[model samples]
Target: MDGGNNGGRINVAIDGPAGAGKSTVARRVAEQLGYIYIDTGAMYRAVALAANRAGVLPSDADRLAELVKTVDITLEPGADGQIVRLGGENITTDIRSREVTLKVSEIASHEAVRLRLVEMQRKLAEAKGVVMDGRDIGTHVLPGAEVKVFLVASVQVRALRRYQELSEGELVPLEQLEQEIADRDRSDESREFSPLVRAKDAEVLDSTELTIDQVVAHILDLCRTKTAEAK
Candidate 1:
């Protein structure tokens, strides 16, 4: 929502549905380009996880905002990967848990929650040179981002990927994974606040057949070209 100007540093926005490889590809592309990788999804997940810990329901917007102001959401990189901390506690693993995944859509639909987090997201990119990935980054979060990419893949592929990830840790039937993906997609696209959407000018990348390295390479080329033209 912040329409500020960037004096330097190329901004890249990667918007995609769940299981489309946006996080992994964005991180790789950012790393290759020496840009900061901002995982906007993790930001929301952090908030939802925090709310759950504090016994605040998804609809409790008033307490959520209060908690937001008091909570410290910092992005730190380590040997494992980017660590998202809330109130100085490392909840990186907690954010990606099943509970947060089930409730995040409801929390994300709250306008106040979105506004507060959008402000934080804006601050992260205010320095300009960053690659951010999320559902709405290219549309509502960072409309003026220099490079906007909307990645997509078939629903079957997405479901399979999610199943694979969940199956690694625990038992998740394919049918359950498929239903979960459909449910999340519907919620994300139908949310009232900043619903998942592709920006008008965003270039769409269908990764149904493309490998992770291929996707990263393609995005890197587009980012480099766009950054050069902006200068």
Candidate 2:
């Protein structure tokens, strides 16, 4: 499907399960296209980190929703990568910690939380020319996005990739990482609100046998083709 141009800003939505390299590929694609890279997952992770710091359980939906309103989450483009700020503090690395990774899905599953965050996400992409990646970006956050790509890889491959990415500081067992990824997949797919599902119009790309550059190139090609068709 061709993504229609909106005020010359092309909106790209990429969705996938955990460890599918959505964030990395999305960043590179955005850089290549010179578009804003919005990591919706990281936004949720920021919230989870705050909730954890505040002693709010993931099951406390009401409190979590209130907490979301109180905190300010911002994403900035940095020389190295996107920097995530929560309430004016830099928690870019904190949100990626194991604790946040374990509870982000639960916090994100809250209906109220999703509503609030989705509103913010839509606002950020209102002008388009953005590449957003998340479990529901194509399915929910940006249903009208001109270019949508659903990236996927085998669980084992994704686990290995994640392990390698995190192996520099911590020594997590490969088997444990695999199970965590599987668990996250189940949680994200089984959630009652905005469960992870591929958008019908999104092109499914399997990255199990593909390199990062290859995936980025494929998506860039899609963007070029769709943009040209739109023009």
Q: How do the residues 173-224 of candidate 1 rate in per-residue lDDT, one tens digit apiece? A: 8888778888889999999889999999999999999999999999988977
The candidate maximizing lDDT is: 2
Backbone clashes (count) for model 1: 0
Candidate 2, residues 1-231, lDDT tens digits: the string is 323435456899999999999999999999999999999999999989999999999999889989988779999999889999987898888998877888998899999889889999999998789999999999999999989999999999999988888846678999999999999999999999999999999999999999999999999999988788776
Residue 203 in candidate 1, Cα distance off native in Å: 0.4
Model 1's TM-score against the true structure: 0.93
Q: Give each model's whole-structure lDDT.
A: 0.87, 0.92
Task: Give candidate 2 misplaced runs (Cα > 4 Å).
Answer: 1-7, 167-169
Top TM-score model: 2
